[model samples]
Target: MPNAAEILVDTLIAWNVEVVFGLPGDGINGVMEALRKNQDKISFVQVRHEESAAFMACAYAKWTGRLGVCLATSGPGGTHLLTGLYDAKLDQAPVLAITGMQFHDLIETFTQQDVDLTRVFNDVSVYNVQVSDAAHMENVASLACRTALARKGVAHLSIASDIQEQPADAAKRSKRNRPAHTPQDMFAPHCLAEDAELDKAAAILNDARRVAILAGRGAIGAAAELQDTARLLKAPIVKALLGKAVLPDDHPYTTGGIGILGTLPSQQAMETCDAVLIVGSTFPYIEYYPQPGKARGVQIDCDAQRIGLRFPVEAGLVGDAAETLRALNKRLEQKRDGEFLGTAQNSMQKWREMMHQSEDSSAHPLKPQRVARAFGERLAENTILAADSGQNTELAARHVDLGVGQAFGVSGALASMSCGLSYAIAAGIAFPGRPVAAIVGDGGLAMQLGEFSTAVRYGIPLKLLVIKNNMLNQIAWEQMMFLGNPQFGCELQPIDFAKAAEAMGGKGFSIERADDVERVLDQAFAASGPVIIEALVDAYEPMMPPKMPRDYAKNFRKALPQTPNRDLIEENVARQPAKTMMEAGE
Candidate 1:
């Protein structure tokens, strides 16, 4: 009979888990041994930190739409997994975290590294359990994976160090010798929209003169359906960042992302639309929704609880995003008049103009938008861009066009920084032939710079684009915009990131001039192994929404020329052309 650890690996293999991300430790020796024995069946990725293991696992799940697995030893190692696991939990990504614990007998005896991992992991995981008995290892392992995939959240399994090496057949079997549960057989199909729900939603869309559609990650596989629905309704499509891939940014009806990282056109569409259809998105920002009672709303999500949590929906369709959209498309009457779409197109044109103006800047300090644009232009059509959370997200949302077959992933609900590098690493592993780039700010890069070693070690060929602004630019801008407070504790002494990459045995390039952006990026992209590019960008750039609140406007004006950099605003304005071109096919 197989050992408990071997049984655990077998169960994971049966569930189709391809790779496990983790760091080895003494407490996990038995599990590690099992992994070593099964190396040919499943792959293990060793990362620098346990937190990074979780982060990579989360990213792997996000990129592949499958359950990502991670492992760690007891106590501190397990504690380190919490942040990344929380990232998966809040983002609704499925991940399974396996941790080793001290021997079960030594639990209350003050054993070294004897932390109560079960209690510690309770909050971050949807399902958590400790496997103390060898016979139940398969059951616990299988259930944890199933629960995570079913609930679309994090699951935790804690195995005692000693029990991990015990024989699985030692415990009593059931009377009939029933087979173990297979996830594929036990998994429930996603809910589909009801006929009445679809009809009601279709009627609302057909009656409304102006419509807006919001798509999220749930709409990933339904791109053509989403586009057709948008065309039928003559609606403007606004994506939550996670749904950035649902439709190309250059799509005539798209207004880009909504909220802080949103475009002006998208915000206007939400405010002015007569009706809204929210599909596959549980975007938490309620303020970004159309004002209450201003527009009728219909929400479609597989999870019923999220149907109308943000907006008051006239009809809530509980079903798969694609399936519901397809059903609605069949019933809804296509709008003939294009007035609403035209207005949206005009606004989108202006938004694109502003973005282009920023993209084409020749300002002395350099424009971050230009860097994003250059990379977007140069990357392979199927490249994956993993962005960091911060002002860089704003830059990416506005400037990076995913229309050229690019895919995007970020620390969405958690809105955490430092995930960019790990995400890029996972994407590289997931799609080895495609280019992967992590667009991170210096502040975020500093937090997980050690992960650079992981990239180099694995030869993942991940590109690191560091916007070296030498400050916590997002928080600094927020301090000024929100509270009218001067920036505090946000400044950083500039570091030569390129040199640091060189020291770490990776290629590095540093660009301070606006003109050098494309050339340096091209060189970085062509590098055979891991590459890091340090781009010096204007520190004073504002990470503002399309529209600012009245009080915020007053505060922002008062903090005029926020950056000490002279002629920054004037330089930016002087660089704008007389008329903005409608480059996005408007």
Candidate 2:
């Protein structure tokens, strides 16, 4: 008879989980032993930190659209997984987290490393439970896995140390090694919109002269439908940052990203369009949405609750984005007007010109955009980009164009830093042979620098591009834009990231001049095993939004410090003199 740990391992294998990311400790020794014994069926990725394990699992789920698993020991080990677990939860990725606990007899005894783990995990997990005993192991493991996959959220299970080694009950043995079911077979069916919902959405869409489509990650699976809908309505498609590559950036009707880290054309489309189609994205930034009462809105989302959460929805079509778009496409009449699309295209062309100029800058301290563009140009057709939050998000959103088959991943709703390296590790592990790159800011890299060792130890060929700007550039910009406050505690001591990589047994390269950007990037991309490339980016460059809110300027002037950093301010003004000057009304 198999022990509870063996039953848990068997159950995971039955669910088709091939890899588990985790750290080993006494609390989870039984499960670790089971994992060792079952090496032929599953691979366990050992990470230095429990947090990295969770982050890696989250990234694996994001990239593969499957249930990712992570394990941790009691107390601090379990607590450490919460940040990454929260990232998975907020981003709505499917992940199953398993942690160990003190023996059942130690309940409320205040034993070392013993805490109320179930209560601690309740907030982050969609489903949380403690395995009662050996008899319950199979059911708990199976249910947790299924629930995570079904709900598209985190599911957590904690097992007492002694319980993990107890033999399973004879009656429950049959369920222990059950064969896996396909995700589609095990989860709920993809919901389709009702005809009435489709008709109402079509009517609203058909009445508008200028229609704009805001596509999010939910719209990724419906690329063909999205393109057809854009054509039918003669609309300009604006993508949310998370949905940047839903359709190729070069699509004729596409205007690129919207919101703060978005393109000007996309912002213009949202501001000017008479009607908007919100598909599969609950983008929370209200300032970027069309002015209230100016445009009628129609939203398509699988979850009905998110239909009108961001903006007021005149018609909400609750269903899968692709199916809804396909149905809505048939009911709508093709609009003959091309003025809106033409304006968007012109604006898009201007934006592209600006981006090209930024990329081609011959400045001594390399423009970060140049690195992003050069890397985008050199990527394999199917390369996957894992972008960090902050300045790196802006750079990747504007500069990295996924050619035909490239994919992009980031910590979407949470916008967490330090995820890029772990995400790249997961991507490299999940999809071997495929090219994977992690685009990160220096700040983000500093937070998770230890993972560089993991990349080298595993020999995972992850391309790590760190933009060394020597400041928390995004926060520094926000200090001015949001609070009108001068930057404080945002500067950092420079580190030779290239040397750091070399210290960890990985190849490293440094780029200080514009002339060496392409050559160094090419060499980094071509090299096998883990590679880190640190680019000395222009510290003075401003991470400007397409448009600033009206209140931003008034607040900026109100809170402007008497002793501001003149050099920083001058550099920013020099880059976008018109916008900066106008914002100050100077």
The TM-score leader among the candidates is 2
Instruction: Write down the TM-score of every candidate.
Output: 0.94, 0.95
Question: Candidate 2: which stretches are off by over 4 Å?
Answer: 170-185, 556-564, 576-586
lDDT of 1: 0.84
Per-prediction tally of clashes: 0, 0
Native-to-model Cα distance after best TM-score fit, residue 224 in candidate 1, in Å: 0.8
Q: Give me candidate 2's TM-score against the actual structure.
A: 0.95
Q: Look at candidate 1 and tell me the lDDT of residue 49.
A: 91
